[model samples]
Target: MEYRRRTVLRAGTAGIAAAVAGCLGSNSTDDEGSIAGEELALATTTSTYDTGLLDEINAAFQERFGAQVAANAQGTGQAIESARNGNADVILVHARSQEDEFMRNGYGVNRRDLMFNDFVIVGPSDDPAGVSDTEQATAAFEAIADVQAMFVSRGDDSGTHTKEMVIWAEASSEPGGEWYQETGDGMGDTLMIADESNAYTLADRGTFLSMQDNLDLEILLQGPIEGGPELLANPYGIMAINPEIHPNVNYQLAMAYIGFVTSPEGQDVIGNYTSNGQQLFFPEALSDDPNFQQYVPDGWQPNSNGE
Candidate 1:
């Protein structure tokens, strides 16, 4: 699959400052020959950034390590594309199947588990499709399709869209009608579109929680809530772009980033981060906690070691 070029949304000014360190003569290089205060590019899913978790993590990482992180927020597919094109040193995304393919194609290395949340079906409170009664994601999708209710799709090749396609396939539906709409935008934007249109859409729990107060939609189906199916569990992972494939990549900084996010300190940050008094992500890296393990998919491994 050829990935088209797309603009990578930089995290903030702190990241951009690092990018111009050379011109500014900041002397950011360390004695150990590391670019301690140099810029590092990270391509990641929109949900992670839209929920404001990525910005929080980026702030901590820059402050603690004296390094600047330029995070490009996009869908998982586009994020991977950025990494593949050498536009990013590392990537953090939730599309496991796509990540597997990226690693297999030698575009990524040191792939490791990060954190997790779940996807939910959200629609207007009126429940026009009556999807609230469905037991699983597929059934809810079927109900929406059967009723010809307004359904908004991310339609941006995002992880959420990929999962929606799987559910639609399981329901034996192609999802085309005047009631179904596509918005080629991020999670937050898509949710707004759904809200304004009173349409049902699939969304990650974190993003939905972050924007719920502003949205007219309600959670119609949640994977963990109503004993929903396993497909709704959304696991996230991080990886450094392979320097071997693209020698111009900042492999050293990328490895450092991968190390930090998987470390105990990083996990704590993710686990403790909250919005509206609700926790958004649960850290599971190198953890044996059964509760976290339940969300991990079968045959899933932290790395090639299967740990």
Candidate 2:
């Protein structure tokens, strides 16, 4: 089968962010895998969907497997919930902590570390809370709390929201009062809320870059790429819902989707995805070797037989 790669919005510094829904891959005969599993439901994060990464990757995936992907963009936590309820055949999300929990709860299996991108703190250019001066994310959060600076939170238990809470914990400050706010929305929407109110908010680098032109906020502090702390690193994972728990899901298609995304072809599509002349996600599924850690939760003790 011939792979017809779809194009993503690659603007200069100004990003023209829009999701790609065009048909990917050539219109040819359906393969056996495609015929066996024609529909694939994916529950994933808003960052992946809003940034249009899925559309680009799905193009290559369809080209190879011929499965039509229908992604339901939601918070990482909500996405997991959807999988647990048998609504999603597979999931792609960031928030490793949540991913670990999902695996622990026996709702997911065949976990694979897919790709990663770092997070950054974006806020008013004036640096009202002095977050611009902080090198570490924890200090930046403490600064925002000290000054009672306006801060908008996703508060939707999304990957971004989880990372924000972890930073607050490290900062040793309980964010409250009129300063901290919750939008209960996704990354793109929360970023807009912060921009609209001139507030401080933690955002994944890709989403912020894609929506930067429409935002007055500036990237005050960066993630690991800019010598920032490792705390801001955002790693995404792909997992097929456990069929033992829900036999109705298209497990075969789910695994095929996983294989395509983690394969050399999938990794290329992910690595090649860019917005505003910057790469959005760095592929990690194909490391030096097959990482079996994906099969277990983080810090799980390995037995002789491999639990």
Candidate 3:
């Protein structure tokens, strides 16, 4: 899959000065050379890039560490594949199952619970298939499937695609035929396709809200953020590519980037990022004890108390 890359270049002097002044409160100007002239390759989901959160946070990070960042936007599956192939130094994504698999395969390390949002079922404003009346996400999906209402799917094996498949499994409905359309694309493009087709689809709340103004879609069913089902909770994680597997990876820079994002400063930027007065991603790593279980595979320890 041809993934689009967005490089977070060093901001202008005024922007860098502003970040150095406050965004990174205690970092002195002398500390800029700590990772000076380094470029960290980041593999992440479209939601982060689409929502423009990286642009805000990377400005501060570049000023503080003097390292440029190239954030590649694509599906979670593609992101992981990039990391596994040693094309990216670090990855930030929301697919827990895939993350667990990557760790189990010894392709990544230093996995940190980074942030979260939720998924919402969106559709045409007229509410075809009566999706608006449904209480659960699965129920809404079932209704759409029942009526064979045109349902657009992010069929590119993304995190959103994984969640959509799960919901379909729970509803015991095989989504296919003329009613089910697969757009093997990222969240932003898939949404545009859905909107143009008058179709219902599952989307991350952040990306949806970021582009809501130009869309005809409405949130017919809420996710965890709106007091909906736990299944829709979209927790994201950041992990560094294990140097042992691929010596070419910038493991040191990756870990540094990880620390900054999970730090209080990083969490603050994430928590404060908003679209049209609505908070997008919530911070998940500020704590007395950091999450160590992210290092282990899922279900390896039944009492691990993780995620």
Candidate 4:
């Protein structure tokens, strides 16, 4: 695949970073030695950044490869487009359908299952919409819409935004007028705004948990394991941009990143990462184990094809 070369480069850098000084090497390099100026560019989602996962990954990657990883954290839609336009060498996103389309079009290759976290509906503790403890996301959304409750949406075409749209569609509600508000910002910012406005919003559990101390809102609903619906499963994946379609892309570096992130060592970091003493990402490799899958929803699948 055209993305193979860039993938190799990314993987090699990550390997080097891991072998050297671990995560400390990331801050030691200048922009010229970073992935942005060298062999790779990573485009990812805001959720990863808000949860502090990307920083950890970047530090380790830089230490192993001695190369800086220039990462643009945006909505999944924009991230995929970045790769399509040769603006990025790799992508880490949670939108499966969009990722599939990108791969089907030859924009990227060698997509691998990286990590996963579930989505949660957050709102005031008073439960204005009476959506707390709801098992069906669609029904919860319906109640929120019917009441015209204050709702804040990322509205940035991000993976979380896309999932919210799906739930709204399933609930047959259109967000408009005063009932809905759109904030084309990252997850952390959106949560802050939501808290200030006392509105409801859909967010990744990791981000919500990490930002919990700064906000007063509570989780209204969680995934099936947490009594939420099965449709709330959120899986994250990584893919390298296809060099054949965009000759300037660094295929080798992108692939190296893919290998490192999906490797056992990388998975261990992901699984062990915590905020407020709660694990943020659940490793797919251990998902089948009784302990690991205990909190995961049934019928959930790890996305590996990037599609």
Per-candidate TM-score against the hidden true structure = 0.84, 0.87, 0.88, 0.81
Say which candidate scores most in lDDT: 3
For 1-307, candidate 4 gives per-residue lDDT tens digits of: 1222233332345443433332232334442143433445789998898899899987776666656687888888888877787788789999887887787687877676678889999999998899974678998898888899999999998899989889888887777888799999989999999999999999899999999998999998887547678888898878777767876666656665776676666777788899999998887633453333222232345689853
Per-residue lDDT tens digits for candidate 2, residues 1-307, read 1111222222221110110111222233433333333667889999998898988988777666556888888999888888888788889998888999888888899898998899999999999889889889989988888889999999999999999999988786888999999999989999999999999999999999989989999999999977888999998999988877876776666776787788777899999988889998899998778777777787788799974
lDDT at 296 for candidate 2?
78
Candidate 2: misplaced stretches above 4 Å? 1-37, 303-307
| Candidate number achieving the greatest TM-score relative to the actual structure | 3
Q: Rate the local accuracy (lDDT) of all candidates.
A: 0.79, 0.81, 0.84, 0.77
Could you list the CA RMSD of all candidates, in the order they appear?
7.2, 9.4, 5.8, 7.2
For model 2, name the residue pairs that clash: none
Better of 1 and 2 by TM-score: 2
Model 2 gets an lDDT of: 0.81
Candidate 3 shows a clash count of 0
Per residue, candidate 1 scores C-alpha lDDT tens digits across 134-190 of 787888888888889999999998899888888898885669989899998999999
Q: Which has the better lDDT: candidate 1, or candidate 2?
A: 2
Worst 10 residues of 2 by lDDT: 13-22
- Clash count per candidate: 0, 0, 0, 32
**Model 2 CA lDDT for position 10:** 21
